[model samples]
Target: MRARNQLLDTDEPGRTVLTRHLPLPALHPVDYARGHAQFEARSDQRRRIVGWLDARLAEHPAEAPLSVLSVGCGTGAVDAPLAAAAAGRAVPGAVVRWTGIDPHGPSAAAFDAAVRHAAPDAEVVARACTFEALDTSDRFDVVTFVHSLYYVPDVLAALRRAVAMLSPGGRLLVLHAPLGALNELAATLAPETDGHPQWWSDTVIAELAGMGLRVHVEELDAEVDLTGCDSADRALLDFTVQAELTDEARPAVLEALRAAARPGGGLRLPHPVTAFTVRPR
Candidate 1:
């Protein structure tokens, strides 16, 4: 199920609102650290994503000098590895460039910094703006929206724009771990209703293919161990909740979060991710 008409007026003129309702938990440092750690420890997922790109690039050897745009590239954890992989490829001086965009002020800065540290020779551009605000006429060899599609206000429109930015034979990749088991558990345990629109998967792919783009959808089984965490991290967890709720509703949501946390340390959480890849037709 896709979200309805929830567009906001942006400071930039003619820019469409990316998201109508923000999730309660605003992006935070702890979450960033946690995500970075996860990526570092679980390099296999990153390897898989890169391997998919390698196959695609190999199929189109004529399309050299890969230009990649990573939408919502939080902290550059994923981009660093991707850049390194591109650099190590056989294509010397192949011009591997990366542009990362994120609305979160600190995240954008941190990602840019990390990119510099991890891949010094790679050209990395970090923009602190909503994806909708990007108005580049140039196309890229690859465009990725990783784990950040759900936050966008208009999923279809965003997908359309991402596809438009892709050069011929270029690919657009969207990676996300939807609220599957987590949503179910949250719904069963909490009073506040939590449900995602079906359009998230079904409509997204249909719309992309309808545009004549070659689309591929892959659902991968993955799990994250959140065990041994206690209420002390309530404040950190609250940031995510606050992103989607009104300020007044935050306290109550925090209480719910506290209830959800395990007493000793952490809560075992299930993670399932879907990756959608599309080539411009």
Candidate 2:
């Protein structure tokens, strides 16, 4: 029996379908960097988020250090980049203290390493704990869930939790994908996985609004280049969509990908990311 990490069971059919269909392996940071460019075109959301944080910090003339809480911070992927961006945009005397929480032990360890490498002077704390079970009394200036909300069993509850952790005038930033062509393809290939189930951008926005939180959304246009990618790269891309096609369905999946390919080279997949900022009313 495979081990279960808190609420996520790695051996479950929905989560392990890709492992059954492909040679799953731990991806390096470089692989992920390319993967980001493959599906998403730019980092507009990240820039906008950092810029907003910069302005928020500026509002506090005291130059007090900022505190950030990042849920499901996988290897500090978003955390590191965000810290770097915030540093560049921060005014004098601005210091950011980041706390990352993730259930995966290895990911937490990697988060520590990545954060240190990215921002040598920043204070970063990595904790291995599920978001639902996290026990902390500290509030934060910013709370973010970047492409990590789906892992939570209760998306609404998770949002509520994050919102409750926000300090006065703090912002809750959530970056999630809309129901787009790429997700549609994944659903087509792995209907059993429920890959895109009930967690699209619209649902999140509606949920926040229902809770009386003011929300604003920004959509980022993204594209991926698969021109020179090898079979491994293709497999990695498929994994992004949570698609695990059987031998019979593999042909159809490939055909659909080809249909979405750009005229020149690579696939012109639709990667529309929505960034929502929630503020208490």
Best by lDDT: 2
RMSD of 1: 9.8
Lowest lDDT sum, 10 consecutive residues, model 1, at 185-194
Q: How many backbone clashes does every candidate have?
A: 27, 3
Report the lDDT tens digits of candidate 2 across residue range 1-281: 22112222235443322223432233344554455545433224445544544454445333567788988887776678767656555557778788899877778888888887887767889998889889999999888887778667677899999999998988888878776655555443333312234366877877787798888888766565444333555545545545433455454455546666657666555555787878887
Local accuracy of candidate 1 as per-residue lDDT tens digits, 1-281: 43322222243454333232233334355564554454335234555555655565455453368788999887787777767666566265667677899887678888889877776767888898888887678788888887677656667788888888888878888876554534332222222213543234554666676677777888765544443223334433332332334445544444434444435655434455678888775
Cα TM-score per model: 0.69, 0.74
Which residue runs of candidate 2 sit more than 4 Å off their true CA positions? 1-62, 88-94, 191-198, 228-230
Please report, as a residue range, the 10-residue window in candidate 2 with the lowest summed lDDT: 1-10
What is the lDDT, from 0 to 100, of the residue 277 in candidate 2?
Answer: 75
The whole-model C-alpha lDDT of candidate 2 against the native structure comes to 0.65
Q: Which residue pairs overlap in candidate 2's backbone? A: 38-224, 41-222, 41-223
